[model samples]
Target: MKKTIALLIITLMVSPVYALEALSDDALQNVEGQAGADLSLKLSINHKLENDKYVFDNGTGAVCADVQFCRLAVSVNNRFIDNNGQASSGDGYKLWLVFKGIQGTINIQKLGLDGMDLSYKDDGGADKIKAAMQLSFDATKPIEIRNFGFNALAFGQDKFLTTAGVEAGSTNASDYGYLQVTRYDTSNAPGSVYDHGRETGFMGVQMNGNLALQGKVMMFGCDASHPRC
Candidate 1:
């Protein structure tokens, strides 16, 4: 028995082992494969009214006291150049596009990444792979947006700036600013004074539905080869 165990140990110690190495370009071209991936996502941005104020749940069993609702704000800077090829003083201004009170649940059952393909193009007498990623999405599951809404759309200059410099662009009376469209009291006669003392906002929208989409989106790099790149 001892001799048998010793023989087995010697065989294992002398056995040859192979290490993995990267495949060459020629070898990689010969390899053919196909695969897909599935994704499930659920997003929610909601708020509740309490004590005449709006509050949001922070997902940790506590209310977010600092701000209300899920907000997205984008600011664009416009600069004007003078005849001397320099930026003119006080000629530059900023425009704000704010979407407030975003409340919705975006549920995607199965977002599929079907496959990827490589496209080749001729460039300067040589064949080269295009600098792009071509992907396809399967339409097996439809995307759902439930109770999606926003309280206001603020688009204008910096009139929404508060005393503390924080942006106040919501429909609230205290934070109301320029270029806001609100609901007016049209219940009275048309000739009577239209009461514009309701809410303040540029626009508001609420929608609920399932969107069916299935297609391929190609993301590519910008270069001189393509005129519209």
Candidate 2:
């Protein structure tokens, strides 16, 4: 029994020597490029949001209705290159809201700051984020969203948010908040949308288990000071 135990110990020690085989050239090539512990992406949304009628909030505090929703686009680039041609892993946000069907683009091009709340970018590698939501609804459309303004800055960044709809009494007042994990109804998620990593930080309203245009008002997120909110 003693001899058997000693032999087993010797065999265990020797096994590692045989197992130390070198990786072949093909195997090395398969993993030649090492990966950083971060993921980066850019976002540009379109066509999914467009209608034949709408309203507008023209910075001057005037609400314009009977408008046509021509285009609503927002692009965010993570690996942005500046004038110096040097690249930095940061958030660069751009937005365009065109109404009246090719009439004009709202003056929201340069959102608050170049490096503001980064929740607008890819969700990974973020330390902290703050979000401001501006919402409005048209009591007359299939999609109650007359205008939805969503903007967030991560890692000490700043941003701008605006929206359009009926008077103050109809929509929720301006409220500041922080971002949170939002689970989308993914049962009907399109394959293409999921494959490209499309995500939204906002939640929508529904009526009686259906999409309806009622006077329902709700918001997501937490108090700006709600520790890790």
Candidate 3:
């Protein structure tokens, strides 16, 4: 009985060792991933990010423009993760869009901007980025862009240079029509003012062609009277 017991124990340990080897030698798997869709974000650039607080609606006491300043800064913050486990971790995705005031005005019937599609999988630890149609911009690095431009048509033949533009007054904050322009005043304030000079009008962006993105943004308030929006 003792010898039988001893032989059984040996077999149990040795057999597991072989099983471990088999698991290690197992074939590699073809991990298939799901494709991504075209995602969009439409930002309603409303208020001025001031040093004191956000100023909106025909700004006064400092930052003010045609009714108030119309230019602003927008961005997308994200991170991209690569596959390979502990060996290689991941990467980061960040981008910024700065708007400069406009000069001459011109209406665009349609403007098609290109974008990147990201494919990924939940690889247990973190989301792995299988592939990306276009690469993401690195937030940490400073990428210089030249001849970056945008413009709009205000009345008829009047032209305006700008970083970005939108129609005024949409309950949601962004409109798809109407064009804006530029002119900087020395009068200084901490940030961009909204609805200062005049009440905000609908930014009729769709007729010209949807900036291709639309959604309501939750700011403390808006480029209007209410700040807690």
Candidate 4:
């Protein structure tokens, strides 16, 4: 019996033991939950004029010679209605909001995202819970945007109209569309010449700033519950 007991004790000491146990409420309360994650983002945009054309580089060694830059065009109020509420014109007549030649370096450090509850006033003036995404950043680290600029903010019937009167669907160099404002460069100027060292565009915006932003973007349904959905 003593030999058998000694052998079992040796086996128990060498082998691994597995067991399941229930935690008390207080113990569970003391347990720590998983913390969220952190994020860092950086964007570098560069552009230059080569042979009367604009070339782009996105921090990489490769250069884009095909007039490839960030461009966003939105058409608003494209549908025209007659007095009888009928369609009047085709999809040609559109007021375009174009943003072209976006070049800059954006740096954001330690941007945090987490789940949070948001409260807002309902349509009946009662406080309610609105779904939201919590966006938080380190106060010590501001969101930095350096050399931020765009070529144009044009408003016209077509998004592809050039200063040379070349309409849309033309496979010309001016096919990138007419810009109400352009960058301060010779390629944007008349006859490829700088206008007395002045920007030829309607407006020139050179933005470099460090912005501090921390908030929750609330999102909810556009139903009877939300007044300003």
Best by TM-score: 1
- CA lDDT of each prediction against the hidden true structure: 0.55, 0.30, 0.30, 0.55
**What pairs collide in candidate 1?**
181-201
lDDT of 2 by residue, 77-195 (tens): 44333344454444221122211211221212111111112233223444444432323333333322223332212221112222221112223211211111122355655753552
Higher-TM-score candidate among 1 and 2?
1
- Rate residue 205 of model 4 by lDDT: 58
Clashing pairs in 2: 115-157, 116-153, 116-157, 116-158, 117-152, 117-153, 117-154, 117-157, 118-153, 118-154
Q: What's the lDDT of the predicted structure labeled candidate 3? A: 0.30
Ranking by TM-score: 1, 4, 3, 2
- How many residue pairs collide in each prediction? 1, 10, 48, 1
lDDT of 1 by residue, 81-152 (tens): 334445533342235476755666677877656434345554454544443345555566778776677756
TM-score, model 1 to reference: 0.45
Give the range of the ten consecutive residues with the poorest summed lDDT in model 2. Answer: 173-182
User: Cα RMSD (Å) per model?
Assistant: 11.1, 26.8, 25.2, 12.8
Instruction: Kindly provide the TM-score of model 3 when superposed on the true structure, using C-alpha atoms.
Output: 0.18
Residue 40 alpha-carbon offset, candidate 4, angstroms: 1.4
Worst 10 residues of 1 by lDDT: 158-167
Error of 2 at 121 (Å): 47
Per-residue lDDT of model 3, residues 1-229, tens digit only? 9999999999888884433433111121233345433333322233343584433333455333452144443533231222321221123221224343321222222222323323333334444322223322223232322112322212211121111232122343222112233333434463734433322333312112112222222212122222222
Model 3 residue 221 lDDT?
12
